[model samples]
Structure formats: structure tokens, C-alpha cells
Target: MTLPDLDPDLAKDMQAIEIRIDGENRCLAAGKVAMPEIAKGEVLVRIHAAGVNRPDLMQVAGMYPPPPGASEIPGLELSGEIVATAPNVTQWKIGDRVCALVTGGGYAQYAAVPAAQCLPVPAGLSMTEAASLPETFFTVWHNVFDKAGLKQGETFLVHGGTSGIGTTAIQLAKAFGARVITTASTDEKCQACLDLGADIAINYKTQDFVEQVKTATNGKGADVILDMVAGDYVSRNFKAAAMEGRILIIAFLNGPKAETNFTPLLLKRLTLMGSTLRAQPVANKGAIAGKLRQQVWPLFENGTIKPVIYQTLPMNEAQAALDILRGGAHVGKVVLEVP
Candidate 1:
């Protein structure tokens, strides 16, 4: 089979299948969307694979809206070869294999990503595995390491241990010399977390995570807590955190509103912070990309860490991929492989 040539004139308008929402229904449809143009600092990527994330589901459900000036499409990360570069772009050129953390527009055949957001595909990783890296890795790097200040020899707790973010967090914290504790819903999922380098995997259905954290840390509690299920977990995480601990909230899967006592904040000297990556400035995301390249990309290159893909469906089967994610049955990322 011959690979398609990257010709700007011929690629002006390509066959880009995009997912569109019909009333309350979301479905993938064939359409002729204009090929993205390279901006001053952007590179046009011929996307081979795109990673599906929880934020995409929220966008499909009409809950999360794309930031101003971002692509209305729902994907957040992708791996592909560079097909074109903006005149000002010097770091990358056509035919470079790269993966990028995009703000939007990753569900199509091509995406115009900021040059700074793109990184060389790690040594010995397929497009599918590389595609799975950016979203979860970026989120975890920012929340767990940057904001939470997770240090070596500390006890770190992550909720939803079987999730893409959870698995990434477990591996990254362990790689940085932290003891990781994670919570999953089932025995099998708990074992999966343990297999992924978690020092302790709590079956949240059978045990209270706060109690488990306290017990595992010998009453010192977790030094850092990466939380996605915030609602009631906010109060519970407060109970599980050690003195001067940090609690970073990236999502509120249950509900954002929480009723928590301020006494813990005052007495424990704890710090609470939250962030949504998509809405952050491009420069900030670019800085994060730089850090990942320097600090985390080597992990993938040397096989010290790897993406755990639960399933890979054709790009046309994007809805099915989202269904698997919504059902919470997947142990890791659900990726969409583009032809």
C-alpha cells in the first residue's frame, strides 16, 4: 500500500470524519471539513491516532464547551506525522513523527497544533501508545507533580486507580520514588492498579479509602491526594491527608459542590488547588510540554513507563469508544485509530 503524499493543494479539503451532536444525540458522521491551516507557530499534523478522554465525553454531553478560538471538535491529544509547518515554525518540518497535546480538533484526519505542544514520538512507541500519552500525562504532571508538589519518599493517593490518569499517576509517582496508593472499584481493578506499581490498591467498594490511607501510612495519611471524584471525596480526602499535605482536584466526576469543614484546612495547614488543562493558556501548556519532554519522555523512551491502553477502535467507531469510557469498564485509555 502506498502512503498518501502530503500535498498542500490536494489536501486543502480532505475527508475528515467528525463527531457531531444531533439534539441530545452524538454520532460520528462523514463530512468535508476544511483542513486546518498552519498558524504562525503551528504545525499541521496528519493524525494517525487520537486519544479519547473524559473531557471529550463531557463535550459530547453538552456539559463542557471548547475554549474561545479552539476547534469545536472533541479530541484533546493525537500522534501523527507532520504534513506541513507554518512559515515561522523552525523546530519541526514535514514528515516528522510527533505527538501533541492539543486544545481541540484532534478527532479528524489532520490538526493544526502549536509547535511547542508537539514532541517527538518516544523511542519504540506506536502511534496508538504515543497518542495515549499527552492528555493523561499532562494532566497528571501538572496536578500531581507541579501543583501538588509530590516529592520523593512521600505517600501519594489517587482515586479511580484503573483510569488512564490513575494508571499514569501511579507509574509516574513510583518512577519519581513516591509510594503510591490508588482506589479502584473491583478486586480485578485493584489488582490491575497493584500491577501498575501502586504500593497499595484499595477496593473502594469494599473499603473506605480514607481509612485505608491512614492505615497504610501508619496514621501519617497521604502526603498528596490526586482527586477526580470530588463531591463527597473532598471531605474524605481532607480526612486522609497528612499535615501540610496537598490535595489537587482535576475533575469532579460525582459533583463539584461539596460540603467540607474548614477546620481541617486550618489545623492541618493543607493546600487545595484545582485546574482544567484545556482552558489554560497555550504558553502554559507549551511549558508543560517542555517539562514532559525533558523529565517524562525519557521514561517512555527507556521503557521505565508506558501507556496502558484498554482498547483501540477505528476512528469511525468513536461513539463506541466513548460508550466504553462512559460505562467505566475500561482499565485504561480508549483510543481511536485513524486510517
Candidate 2:
């Protein structure tokens, strides 16, 4: 694999992972792609690391595609030093270390990211840990804190307690003074959730989460629920929510289809909402970056909250990284190092 030159060669090709589909299988193979151009308000990053995510798997399987004008290569988050900057960009100059949220093209030696969507790597973290932050942190902060308005002293519940999003949500919610509850597939994973500061951790495989939540909250139910498994969990979430509760959906790993009853929603006065960050406007994502920098970055700086990286693989092993993510046995973030 060729590393970028001492000075970036923006006109040349760069190594990246490309999707090759044959029959029912989608393979991540190595290839060369042209270096991305830095548009106005954008900067070209010499990517040190890129975070693997479920969306990358979905894109490889043809279930998800890059939005219009996005690069065909798949990666949602990355950390690196700025190699070049757009003429109009001022906040991030060449040589700045930043982690950014991108619509696409993160699985490469270089990615062009909007300046507003980039946040400085927190003081104590490595590039691999910084790469892990943009996606889960942004999603959790937006859905759980910004949208759901999870308040201090409120009870918060998140499914998939060992997932990248789950670990992030657990730590963030705990740091903000919320009582956290999370559900995982195993007793060990439940213990992992408890270690992340969750007040309660339910093993959904052996236990009925609805019952556990009721008992934990003393029959009042959780004040806010962050759900990624939506199928039957939809109705279950409705049952686990408190009166005037908020339920935010970010993904549907159990399948998006569900047979849901609306009676509980009406009776419980539950507010159901969902969002995806990739397709949102750059301004919206930039605003989220600002919030994380101002509100969440301090947590990292002070060691109150930290990114949890389960594994790191070479950039060329992106498929292996995705395989680890697909298998669902891993905890926290899986990252790919460019060098």
C-alpha cells in the first residue's frame, strides 16, 4: 500500500477499499481511486484512521448507497491531519488534527471533509480513538441529548448495550447525570454495560427487558428510550416507556418492519422520533460538531467519558473489520489504521 507523499499529491490516485459484488456476495477489495478535491469550506485529510460502521456494510450489500455527490467509497467517520484546505476555509488549516463526519469516501488515504464538520481530536486520545468518535458520538448526542432532551435525574434506556452507539450513549448519559439502563444479548455484555456506568443492564436474550425495565424503574418505566432494534421491540418500547416519554429510533437491526399497537403511544403520551445523520445538511452536522466540541469534548479532556475502541485493523483489512462488526460479537468501535 502506498502512503501519501511527504507533500500530498492531490492529482494522483490513492489506495482505498472498493466494493465488488458477485452473485449474493459483496466483497471489499483493494483498489486505487483519485484523490478527493477540497471544495469550498472543505479540507483534504491525510487519513490516519477510519471507523468501520454498519452503514458501510449496508452500502457493500447494496442496501445503502452514498447520497448524491458523495464518493462511492464507504466510510462515515475518520481522523487525520489536514493536508490541504479549500481557499475559503479558515477554521481548519493544513496540519490541523481533526476527526470528521463525512457522507462518504472515508475508506481511503485521503478524504475531503467540510471544515464545519470537523472537531479537534481531544487531548488524550490517539488517532484510532478519535476516528471512533464522529459517528456514534454525533448520533447519540443528536438523538438522545439534542432531540430526546434526556434530562438530568431522568431515567434513560438504550438497547444494544455493547454496540458502538450503546457504549457511547451509556457513558454520555451517565456523565450528564441521567440514570442509565441498557439491554444486551449476554450476561457478559450486560456486565460491560454496567461497567460503563449503566444503572441497570438487562440481558434481553434470557430476560424480558420490558419486565426488567418496569422493576428497575419501580413500575414507572424509562423516561427516554433509545432503540436500534425496532421489530417487536417497537411494541416493547411502547410498553417500557413512562408517561410522556420519548422514544428515539436510529436503526432497526431486528428489521424495520413491525406490527405495532398505537394505543400505548396515545395512553403513555410517548413521543416517537428517528433520524439519520449522513443525509442531513452539512450545516446541521456542523452544528452537531460544534455542540460536541463545546459540550462533550471536555468530558474526553477531563477523562470523565472516553471513546471505547474494541479493535483496530490495517486499512487494507477493511472487510475483516466489517466482518467483526457484522458478526455482532464485538464491543465498541472497530477502526482501520491507514498506515
Candidate 3:
């Protein structure tokens, strides 16, 4: 098939994987769909790999849908080589390898990404490792540093420390000289967080994270908290949070709806904020990509921060990939290679 000639620098040949709903509890995966047309200010990417995320699973379950004007495909991030670029864009070429934060459509053989939302893949990282960076890293960075304003010597609590976002948050916070406290369910998961530079790892299954955190900090409480589990953890997080603290909510793995007292928030001068990548505008994603490339990419390039890949599965074996993520047996990222 002849793809649209949207970018003079883009290769004419491209392909993609698509997700279509078949019925309840069944998702039909379509492979080798036609390459996407490059819209204005967008570039066509020859996607090498894509990161699997919990949000993708939510979309598959019909609990979430792509935000307005976003791609219908479920993926949120990808790493790939540039195949084409539209007019008025410079500073990138057809062969540059990059990891991008996307609104959706990373689960494909090819994707069209806004030029401003793309970051050059670090020099030493492989496509699999690079593919793991975008969604988790960007989410953590925005919530922890940009929104929460975490500072040096402050204690930051991260839930799900063995998951992709959890591990990434631990390293990034440590890299910036912040103290990290993470909660994991298993002993091994707790150790994994410690190995990644977290100051303290709490096994929430065996102990109460709030008490552990308070005791660890000499009763001062955590300066900032990054929580994905919002149900019961909400009250516990507030209890463990320090005066004038900030809590950033990125996901609700346990549950979204919660009943909590507002007195603690008012008395402690705490700030509560929530964000999601799929729901944000292109400009915001572009700005994040630019900042991460300038600030965080060097750490990746210099070996300060690296992707912790758990497994890789070919794109065709998507169900197996989903099963692995759903099983929650692995740490770090589970990547799907297009090749």
C-alpha cells in the first residue's frame, strides 16, 4: 500500500499493529496495518519496541479510552528510529533513534509522534531499554519533581516500588539527591527497591508502611509521597506525609474512589494533585520531552540511570506479554519488540 507522502524525509514503506475490540473479554490484535500518515508537526517513526503499561490494560477492559484527538491504539510510549519528518521540522533525521512520550499508539510497527515529544535514545542503551524509559520516567518526573517539588534530603514515599514506575522513581529521586522510601509487597521486591538506591523499603504485606515510614523518619513523616494505590493507601499516605508535604497521584491500581478527612490536608498544609499522560495536551508532552532530554538523557547516556528490563516478547506474542504484566511477577519493564 502507498502511504501518504506527508514527510519528504520519511520512508514510504511502513507498517503498524492495531487493536480492535471483538467482544467482552476478547481483544483482537491486528498486525501489519498500513503505516500512519504524518500530520503537520509530526514525524513517522519506525517503531522498534513499545512499553506495556497498566493504563493500556484499563483501555482494553473498556474502563479507559484514548483522550480526544489521540490515537485509538492503546500504547502510551515507544522507542524507534525516525523514518520520516514533516516540513518545518529540523534537528532530526530519518536515522535518528528516539524514545517518545505519546498520547497513544505505541503498540504498533510504526507510529506518528509530535516532533516536540521525542527524545534521542541514549547512546549506550539498546532499543529494548530505551523503549522502557518514556512512560514511567516521564510520569515520575512530572509528579515527583515538577509537581511535588521534591528537594534534597526530603523523604519521598513511592508505592509499588518493584513495578516499572516504582523502580524508575527510586533511581530518579536518588539521582537528584532526595531520600526515598518505597513500599513493596514481597521481600524480594523490597530488596529490589533498596538495590535501586531507595533509602528504605517497606514490605507493606508484612508491615504497616505508615508506621515504618514514621519510625524511619523519627516521626517527621515523608516530605512527598508518590502513590498509585489510592484506596486504603490514601489515609495511610496522609498519615505518613509530613507537614507542608505534597502527594501526587498518578494511578489508582487498588481503587479510585476514596473517603478521607480533609482536616489533615488543611492542618498540615498538604497539597494533593493528580495527573495522567493520555489526558494531557500535546504541548505539555512536548515540554516534558524537551526537559527530560536536556536534564535526564545525560544520566542515561552516562550510565547514571539505566533501564531495568525484566523481559522482552515479540509483538505477535502480545497476549503473553499482557499475561506477564497482569501476573505481576516481574520487576522493571516488559517490552514488546516489533522485529
Question: What are the clash counts of all predictions, listed in order?
Answer: 0, 0, 2
RMSD of 3: 2.6
lDDT of each: 0.90, 0.92, 0.84
* lDDT (10s digit) by residue, model 1, range 1-339: 112476655476765556676787876666678777777898889999999999988887778889999988779999999977887889998899999999888888899899999999999999999999999999999888888889999999999999999999999999999999999999999999999999999999999899999999999999999999999999899899999999999899989898888898779999999888998988998999999999999998898998999999988888888899999988989899887
Q: What number of backbone clashes does candidate 2 have, counting pairs of residues 3 or more apart or in separate chains?
A: 0
Candidate 2: TM-score? 0.97
Query: After TM-score superposition, what is the CA distance of residue 331 in candidate 3 from its true location, in Å?
Result: 0.4
lDDT of 3 by residue, 1-339 (tens): 234444433344344555665655556375555457778788878889999888877777788888888877768889998877887569678788998988888888789899988898899898888999999988988889888988988899999998999999999999999899999889999898899998999989899998999999999999999999998778888899999999988888878988988788888999988888777877887877777888898998787888998999887777677788889988998999986
When summed lDDT is taken over every stretch of 10 residues in candidate 2, the lowest stretch is: 1-10
Number of the top-ranking candidate, with TM-score as the measure:
2
TM-score of each: 0.96, 0.97, 0.94
Error of 1 at 165 (Å): 0.4
State the number of backbone clashes in model 1.
0
RMSD for each of the candidates: 2.7, 2.4, 2.6
Clashing pairs in 2: none
The better-scoring model by TM-score among 1 and 3 is 1
The better-scoring model by TM-score among 1 and 2 is 2
